[model samples]
Target: MGAFSFLSRVLHTKPSNYSKILVLVSVSSGGLIAYAESHSNNETKIVEQSQPEPKRKRVVVLGTGWASISFLQDLDVSSYDVQVVSPRNYFAFTPLLPSVTCGTVEARSIVEPIRNILKKGNGKIHFWEAECLKIDAKEKKLHCRSNIDENLVGNNDFSLDYDYLIVAVGARVNTFNTPGVLEYCHFLKEVEDAQRIRRSVIDCFEKAVLPGLSEEERRTNLHFVIVGGGPTGIEFAAELHDFVHEDLVRIYPEVKDLAKITVIQSGDHILNTFDERISTFAERKFQRDGIEVLTGCRVVSVTDEFINMKVKATGENVKVPHGMVVWSTGVGTRPVVTDFMEQIGQTNRRALATDEWLRVKGCEGVYALGDCATVDQRKIMEDITSIFKAADKDNSGTLTVDEFEDVIEDIIISYPQVELYVKSKHLLEVVDLLRDYEGNKQGEIDIEGFKLALSHVDSQTKSLPATAQVAAQQGAYLSRCFNRWEQCKRNPEGPRHFKGSGRHEFRPFSYRHLGQFAPLGGDQAAAELPGDWVSMGRSTQWLWYSVYASKQVSWRTRILVVADWTRRYIFGRDSSRI
Candidate 1:
């Protein structure tokens, strides 16, 4: 009763005191809310800062040739940490290498630095100017050695770890263990090789004009012999002819009539890879240009002064005197590549064998392409058989037209090479033709008939040619597949659409042959383009220029090529030795 009476008296004491107390309570509540909000914001930022960054996979690419460069250009580097190892630090534009030998184009103009190319990428990329010595596939590592001069101060050997490995080390010139070939012959495969050839040609011209020289000596000094009938050999011969006629004739008249160019080919015809019409055309052009094309001849031995050949038609040994011999007799697997294949237990002796997806056989996380690898056709046949069995459903040994259609669809999804063949009505007609099989008592398409159908598709999708177009396409396809795989890994629940389908599967590589072109002398060229775009002469020459100019790997290189062409046109080739 006393406490109630005291509270009633205090409540009635003053209205001003009650208002001040209420204001103080409200201020304290506002301070408490502000502190709580500030603490929550600070905690959220702290948590974000403490979280770890996602790790990236390591991708190591071997060689900086056409295949490797194309893959690097198309790859999404942000998804992986990339490292490139090669004996060369720059990518040489091989097609223009012939021009370098005669000074039609500068050697440096065709070479692009690998570091410069990597600078254009969004992710960090490391480059090592080294040669890969061995591949430890079981450990996912590569043993490499410095290719730089031994006099230089640097680590001589090192090992690199990789989650993925790309083997693109290209082939080396094949001498077939011929005596004196490697020591005496000049190969036009690199920049230094072209420079050496140029110097040798100039030296030959200078020696031929020397006073008191015998007729035989002069003739031998001015003769240039090229071994091989491939595109490289033919193109080099053409360039040499142009250099002699257009430039050397004006500069050195004393030995003008002494120079001779000869090409020895083992095949029945030069440019045998081309169509018969094109081959005949090229041969006739060579004949008119005074460039002798000796078909059906195999080089037996090479010496400092002469090359001995065995003529197939005559079966007689012939010795041709020459001041310079250029060996472009095709390529063979390098020692490193051969060793890697052997170490990996790959059965292909000529090159590394790969499945249809370009994955190296008998190895994981390893892939091979370019001239170093060949697709295993037997494995592809086995895959085709598995696909056929899958479509047979109900454990039946034979299939109907509808079942065949299902198989075709499945193949189209898995093997992009057969997509074009399968999508057309021609495939349906093929199936209909196979429906009338006499051996099948069930009146259905038997396994033999399926195999026949696959054989037809196989012809269309067999081994791809070892060409720049095929290499570039393969690199692009692999890049796309890797990128898709990375994305699918990040999102396990995603569609997992990769090369063609799910995460575990990859679409077989499909090579599209764009065209083939070769330069003839006197501002003329020849091209066998797809469809009906066959062309030759000056028009084809311009087409060649435009195609190569646009195809230059970088804008800087394209500009330099254009400038070089213009300079050559205005001033003629620089014949003076550098």
Candidate 2:
């Protein structure tokens, strides 16, 4: 009865006290729920913080020429933070530069802004209009100075750090230190150079028309002398011929008869790099076109009014008066490149030395290409040894000329870089020379003898032609290798590290020769296709146009170039100087 009375007292407690107990329970439940939610949010934040950011390597490109521009175009920017340092901010289509001097093409039409190219990349690319002064490979840094005039007083000098550096700063025209040559001659390596030549040509013509000038003086003022029978000099001579025949006949008829274009080649023939047949054809064409081509003549010196040449065969000296001279002889290493090579102990004095993979010798994380670099001879020797191993059926340790021919064929099949020489018949000549070597009396060459003979052959075929095509191919190749290397780094388990010494870790660069084409004035062009085929005439002229049009770097450039050509065809070139 007492327990029942206590239970009844508890059940009948006051309504206010009951409500207080209910509130306590509700508050405790709410607090526990809030704590649980807060803990969940904190855990999510921790996870978000723990996730890693994507890592990108830094790449520094050192030029704005064909090689550097093509590399930038092919680079996977998302994988790199790219910085470009160059004095110029645009890429000039060098193949068309000769046309610019003759007014067949405009200067601006052949240039593409470097900024526009970089903007097309996946990530933001930094560009500095500065000249690279020195590279501290040990520190992976570059010493650069602004090209802007206001910053020339050491104010805009700065240092840049990079994980990878590309040295593609191309070579400069070599004057051979000929006396007065630098003062009297003009070069054609840059847009400014072309502009200067055009201005000088026009000035010469204007001066020749002056009333006080005698016939001899007029002839002297109208003469155009070109040195170095390489493709550049030949092309310029052809263009000048067309300009004299087509434009000068109408604009300045008074000097047309006196105007003469002469190409002075130190070698036996102009276009000596091309096939002999092609060289013969070009010489014939020039002869028929009334352009004087003087071969086996070495220029001894140059003056403002005359050039003295020694006939290599007769040992006789001859002097030719000239109003203008264009020197397109060859290229030499820049002072900066020479300094860098010296610091790195590179043996190649003419250019930067690189391995088969285009990695600069003695410098890690640095690569070089274009006319500025030469691949190591040891790489070529290695390739030759591998080819010999494959071709040695009897394992005799010696190879005949026939076997060497087979080796050349094998190289053509395996390596694209040699395709140009092979297709152009240079490889066959190399084989012939090997067969005729005095040491190989029995017509069989031992390994060492083969290597010695090959060194000579390599001297003939080692460096690639310093053409825009070669540069572009090298640029694209390096970009691909870099992308693959980065991918390999990201995937450790996939294969060996890209830097490992595996035989196939990274493929060495091989350049495929597309073909060669040159416009010969008067709606005629000549082209040597891959293999033994050669084409010429008007149809080939159209082919030349189409090929160059297809090679235009951008759609805008293509349109501009086409429009410029069309305008020249319909309305003639604008001869007015700006």
Candidate 3:
């Protein structure tokens, strides 16, 4: 309906022009696109640019990511101003990022374009491809900076104002300040990271084929070193191992013999989050595949030439040169959160300290979720009578490992003869034949054996394996909360705000544990679902494919993904990298 609206649309499609438009338009307030036409009666009827009618409520969601996607799907947009802002314009199906790095899956295959996502909603959802740098709580506005490229916008920076805000910017790869790591090691947190890995890996191979290379020199030059024994690192290593064995030998035999891969883990065993049995299984499997698994090793420093790693076994340090070094350690708070905290003078250990409902403390009309914030899930922390602050927590919810230690003393008095065993024989697997996890990731209940063998049957459960299951479920949780919050706001007298926010008020969110799965490469996968179901091999992969197959954001995307998967299965990896 205004002058700037038309120009905005053009910039939306080809965002490279953002800077130039910003400079040209900065002379006026962000003018909306307007075109005037004269009527027969000398009256001008302005046809304002049309967008999907938004819901009555203004909900500006930051980060078009896992949590926001779920919220968008469930939100009745007819009542809210649903706006999404993020650096990337698409939702990257992160479980497949490792595959992207290994050249097994294309980056586009894992990314669902945001424009397509909104179109499928058939609603006018405003999108600002920018980073939210600040929040003016009193103004109830989101201050954002769009980095659409300086050449296009004349300046790389611009601002966006929003009404209600949801911060879902997820975590970033944490290096723990390892010396030289940030300078030399590559990370696997985004598509750019994956592309760089693939390109640099191939580039190294080409370099190794130089005319005057010695055998030892060539071998060291082609080695790949991976840090972290977590899911991402394990999965990437597995994919790389598969690529070398499956395609590299057949396609690039000249340097195949020189290719070596190693995984250095700081824990006693790989897959430390999984069951001990599973970790042992993975360790043996990696050993069998000629992949050096270095457990109990810490990386002290890394340089362009090689890395310095200390092993507890040798009680000394060692150095190894690698062509590619991928650091897949855990995640930490994102930059936006850190910046926000610094701006607000926050002292919470996390980027954003939130309540159970995921509302940022000291700020109203603003919420934070996903990896960027640390929510003391009021339900999970209600009982800490003498904790950091006055937050709602039931005594039951305040139970920590230290609190559990007190119970052991009482048990000792009740039953004098107490024997403790370290292992768990009661490993219960979920058996949901119809439900499948996205990555063949799994959830299993592993109960530890307790003392006082009178068969009282003590149990400790390790459920849902903190993999994609937790992430997906958390995403779904935020969606439900957003919808509920919108509804409660509309009614005003509606039952919202429960226990923690006030005295015996506010509804608590109960987390549901779903199944977990793991992709073991090639026509192979594994899943443990509810009801003691454990499946693997071709059958598991088929179910896994069909599960995520229906979860694509759009029908066109669904069809493309299916076609691509089938195409790859039949003809193999597109034989080209884009």
Give per-model TM-scores: 0.84, 0.79, 0.72
Tens digit of lDDT per residue, candidate 1, span 171-265?
88889888889999999878899999999889998888889999789889999999998888899999999999988988889778989999999
* Ranking of candidates on TM-score, top first: 1, 2, 3
lDDT of 3 by residue, 68-105 (tens): 78767676676666778888889887777787886777
The per-model lDDT (C-alpha) reads 0.79, 0.79, 0.64
Residue pairs in collision within model 2:
none
TM-score of 3: 0.72
Q: How accurate is candidate 3 locally (lDDT)?
A: 0.64
Which stretches of model 2 miss by more than 4 angstroms?
Answer: 1-55, 151-154, 377-461, 490-505
lDDT of 2 by residue, 284-372 (tens): 99999998999999999999878999999999999999999999999988877988988899755888977667888888889998989
- Cα displacement (Å) at residue 432, model 2: 18
Each candidate: RMSD to true structure?
9.7, 10.5, 14.4
True-structure Cα RMSD, model 3:
14.4
